[model samples]
Target: MMSISPHQVISAFDEVPTVGHCLVACITITSVLYGLYQWLLPNPVPGIAFNLEATKSLFGDAPGMIKEVSVTGEFRVWCAKQVKKMDSPICQVFIRPFSKPWILLADFRESKDVLMRRKEFDKSSFLSDGMECMGSFHGIYPTGDKFKWNRQLIQDLMTTSFLNNHVGPAVYSKGLDVMKLFEMKMNLAKGRPFSVKKDFEYASLDVMIEFAFGKNWVHTATGPQVELLSKLGASEVKFDALDQPVSFPIAPIMDFLESVYEAPEIVEKTINAIMPKLQTWWWSKQSWYKKIFDEKERIMKEQVAIAVNNYRSGHVKTGIEHMLMREGARAEKEGREPDFGSEVFRDEMFGDIVGGHHTTSGAMMWLAKYLTDWPQIQSKLRLVLYETLSTAKEENRLFTFEEIRRAKLPYLDAVIEEMLRINAVTVTREALCDTTILGCPIKKGTQIFFVSNGPGFLSPSIPTDDSKRSETSRAAKLNDKWDETHDLTLFDPERWLVRKNNGEGLLEDDVDFDGAAGPQLAFGLGPRACWGRRLAHMETKTLIAMLVWNFRLLETPPALSSHAGFEGIARVPQQCYLRLSKI
Candidate 1:
């Protein structure tokens, strides 16, 4: 070969890689590849349809959902739209990075079966974790001994005896207060629409507070506002606009009401967050959060003390007193001291106040919006109410709680059911073990969100492979199909009425209300379904009856009547404006 100089040999050796350099280079390449495989890539459960592009990205479905929420301010609608987008009754959505994908199930039959009969599913950690900040014990607990015990504690609150005898009058009286406030506003508006959202919230808070605390609990939000408004004449009360909806000043909310109102907002934020526990911790450290937490604690303690004293004096009438009595009975039976101040007791009381007020308020707000939109339905409903409660109408007085409850007015039922169907509530369930949903294998620990606004409830259902469905779901007798003759998406009350032919060989107007006439999960289903179902129905019906019976909900401008919703603990309407004419 040729003569090689020492300098050339040294230069060649210097260019060669050393062991230390090779080790560092190998580690850097391994880390990048590992990150792409583990963190950046979207690994989905097999056999479940998912967005192809979503699977290619590191953020997967989260970026799309976040963008949708940011633009529309509706997370609930975005959730339901994913099922339609996938064109599958059951689909996978990878939202949380590096975590298991969420299963979005749209089939009502499978959903019902899973909620009602399937033992493999239970309350997911997704729900419990979001609510854990409230307390250790409540209805959000997974199906277990703890959940059962919690249910037993508050089971009596929903009893027919307690609801009719105790809660009915309180809710009715509150409803009257709301009507009174609206009547005053109607006079001031002189045909202009006024925002009734705060009125609804205040009234609901009043009812729920009395229910949880007691009739003796005198801290009333609406009561004070109503009193304050009464002092001011029609001229004194100012309006921002004559043609559009007027915004009126509301009374300062009590610490208790403020705390309850704020708790759900925090819960919503934590649930939607990527890191819920960390988010909750951060929230817990905030001054506002601490104030609300402490305020709630102070109010609960004060109310419980009052309730205990009342119970001793044989004045037990509210939900908390009933709970204390239950604990006492349990303590007597078990021969141990009743833990009246237990976390379970406090949390359950607070939970009821939080959930009860929000759910009822949302439904009522929506009912007002619907009434304004469908004047024919509203007039028909009003006529039905007038005829059904002729005795009260003739007397020029509102119907009694018992009278409304005892009435067999099918149209009223149809209206409420339709409202509920169109505003279907979402329920989330977790696969307790490895299971198959609609024939697709769902891994254990998967969170399956049951949304009612999609598929069978509000839109045409996605094509499902019936052969793949579980045996129970396929054979479910309670799987009732919707009548697609009418647009399933429209807000039509007649869809819930069962019209039969008379002996004259003609269709009769005497239709009976059939709640099972279609697919809906408004209050959920199964044993774990909303225990507050009866309470919610009664409150909504009574309030709707009272409002329709007392005033006609005149239509407002399109801007004032927008059906856009803000998804919180419930999907409440953004606008609940009403132009009222006293009957």
Candidate 2:
């Protein structure tokens, strides 16, 4: 409006170009930032950076067999003579090619910190993936609000009360079933070279399936269900090795093979076809046939249906049933939709069976091998078990939880602990968040791993430096060599047992056998700790007690060489040929 000079007009035109250039620059910066974000935040993969190479280097390379490597930087320790050479409780190692870094923590104190802080860390994606892979039948994978809801339901079910009331009986009955299988095998073998491992696997599978699904899948005679169960078990064992890190695109291929060989497209197609029928049977409001059909549903509808039926019938007699009923009721009360139907429930039940059964069996195998190799310790265990069972009806009779508790077998406990420490059955966990561990800054999405095969023997008898009379005496007496591999070879149960100077009696000092304050890292630490620890402990203890109580285990003539075998996802004990005989 005001009279503009020629300079003012030119200035206005110049401002227009300036504004356009500023906008272009802003757009360019934003584009670059977006690209950078994409590069930094890649999609999650199960066991993404697990250090397979390190595991091979440490455990001796079993090419094609070892799948995933733990991200724990433990290779140095593995090669070293001791378990605590690293300054921190956990040590970090970065692998090449993928830049996969792992934290290897064997220090008990640091492990405790990680184990106790559940909210800060969670079960790694690797664990979740395995669970999901097994839980697919029930849609347990693809965790959502529903999966959360279902997990809540399951938590209630796995409580001690439920375990005592229902699951205990089922487990006991299943134990009997397993015993029968062992007996049958014993009879058939008649001192022949029979594979007890294979027999134990089948028996455990049968027991778990029966308990979860309310039906038996294993048979002396082969059929579809039997064949499928066998295939699934074998496949699970194979997948355990492959559950490691590598550049190879093997997951899809493994999945495809597992699908084709084990359960197959036909199995899924059959399941899909039967799903509608199963739903009809499950949802029928007015049918008395619900009970009859529910029992039958174990085969068709899977374990969830069996559990639901048990719940509806007011039979909270098993762990699975208890979990299902509690979950269902809680969901109703909270006005949340039920996440687990019959199919999902079945998947979870089967998951427990598959996940738990072999581990216990494997422990038993090791117990047999160790006890056989160390007869003196076996005698000690037998004496303790016999004395504990003195008031019981018979030696071979199924032992109760109380009896197991009272036995207080230190050597037996130590042997089991040693096996768990030396021969790990599970893989290391992945870190979920950017967290500082033992004063080291761990970025978010780091894969944390651990190994049990170390030379550190967690013993209560070992004298602490503080307890010695003089600093020199402490240093001389408590030599660093005690922490070395040679000392670890002294896997004597008495190392856990405190003794008097007289060597004639036991010390009155309380033994913290659980390693609550000691250097042990078997079950892992933090919020994502093993959910089934109690069950696992009980199973291991029971199997050990039973085997040691009756049978005398002998190490094979050649000392039965055992290696940790890999089948992609699982790290398991390689087949050990052992010698066994009736006590």
Candidate 3:
């Protein structure tokens, strides 16, 4: 009514906005700011950023074959060199582009600390994923209450008695078979240059199959199991990027021929394949096939059915059966439904075969290599074996567990310890929570790593006249005077032996045999340690003793240096080329 001018109208429009319009604008601004804050402050610490440009800068122009990949994305270095130079254990930080915060422990003490606390931390996502893929047949990848209960059940199965009575026999019989194969092959070649790894694999597979299935597939020299085992072992070492997040793709391929036609996929695949007919016989009696649909549950049912039938019929006498019958009976008496799943028994058997066979075989191959490389040590070992075997009866001819226990062969013990120290079998456990480790603040979900040695391995801090010299100076001197003059690089078992005759040595010096006894992180520590440790030790020692007792192993000359060798993972010998002759 007051005849508003155009200038006045424009001023009013600019001064104020509708309440709805203002609210919408404010909401948009808040969202953008919140998104920026999230981008800046992520919860889980982001792992090492993958910089393709940085990677290329470090290793792109490097010459020759790239031997190993470094944790820092650097390449073109040998594994040994990486082990010496890299700060992280196993030469890998395990920090993928999106992986959570990880602290890799290269120092042995730090590794011990982490391993000692198994209850607080669990297996990393990667290992769990791997077990899930490979162990779907037996429900190995359980979670929550099921996982806890199942793990307890499996632990009971791995008792000392079961290993000594059941698993030990299987290992011993297989070891003898391996010795026979070695003798046969050496005879055929007339002590020619041959890869020992292949033979070891055959032996290991034969043993594992027999233990799992209750029969030896390789007894008939021309069996599919032999070939399949070889293929499986070979494939096991190669890392498949595709299987990183999930392991399903590789499971079916383990039995490709059988799986190709989809011929009634029954019985747990992977470790339980060898005992398929036995498992199927048990499964036929179960009515739960119509009720259970979950893959793991179904497979667990089959394994449990086998275990239950065996227990009831008294067919299976040892291993998981013995443990289950004892524990299950106790639980039932206490008015508690054991709640012990079939998966528990299955995992115990599966874990024994998977964990035992390969590791023992690998160790034997490495020991053989060490003996061949250092003939003096081999001579000493043979002398000891001869001495031990000479005084034994026919019944005691084989190196039994009791004999190894009573035998105070320091040199042999030292050699085995040294080999294990130098080449650890596996890097186990990872952090699942944010925690401080060795004063270092590790974030949640970090891949905590452990190794066999620390700064002591590379830099001698032990107070000796040699310690006065700086590591750089010692390294330079080593380079200048590096020859076959008892170089540490040269495998020397005598370094472990105490030379009492050397009058130059002081009597009360603190000799640090740091890793000799105590707890070995190799088989793990505390309750979660390897269940088949004794069986593995017996198998490895027996095989090695048999070989050293019956045959002389010598390294091939340079003319035949180029030969197929063993490939390793974690801490395994890649290959061993040696000439074997009957003693």
Best prediction by TM-score: 1
All candidates in order of lDDT, best leading: 1, 3, 2
What does candidate 2's lDDT look like per residue over 1-583, in tens digits? Answer: 6799999999898777577799999999999987765444322223222333443332222221212223322232242212243323345443321333555544333344455643455555433433333443322232346556556646755567755544455555555554544443333333432335544444444444444544323332112222333333322322212212111111122221122122321222222221333443343443443433343334435445656677788876554665677677877988997655645565555455555555555666666666766788778777767755666636546577556644566556666776665555333555666765544666776656554444233322222224412222233322231234335544455544443355433222233244331345555554444456666665667666766665666544442434444222223345544444566
What TM-score do all the candidates reach, one by one?
0.93, 0.62, 0.62
Task: Name the better of 1 and 3 by TM-score.
Answer: 1
Of 2 and 3, the candidate ranking higher by TM-score: 3
Q: Where does model 2 exceed 4 Å of error?
A: 1-100, 118-120, 129-132, 135-148, 177-193, 214-300, 336-344, 393-410, 425-433, 455-486, 498-514, 559-571
lDDT of 3 by residue, 435-480 (tens): 5554445666565545433333323212223343333323431222
Predicted model with the maximum lDDT: 1
Cand. 3 Cα-lDDT: 0.49
Candidate 1: stretches off by over 4 Å: 1-40, 239-241, 478-481, 501-509
What's the lDDT for all of these models?
A: 0.83, 0.47, 0.49
lDDT over C-alpha atoms for residue 377 of model 1? 84
Q: Cα lDDT of model 1 overall?
A: 0.83
> RMSD in angstroms, candidate 3?
12.2
Please give the RMSD to the true structure for each candidate, in Å: 4.6, 13.0, 12.2
Candidate ranking under TM-score, highest first, comes to 1, 3, 2
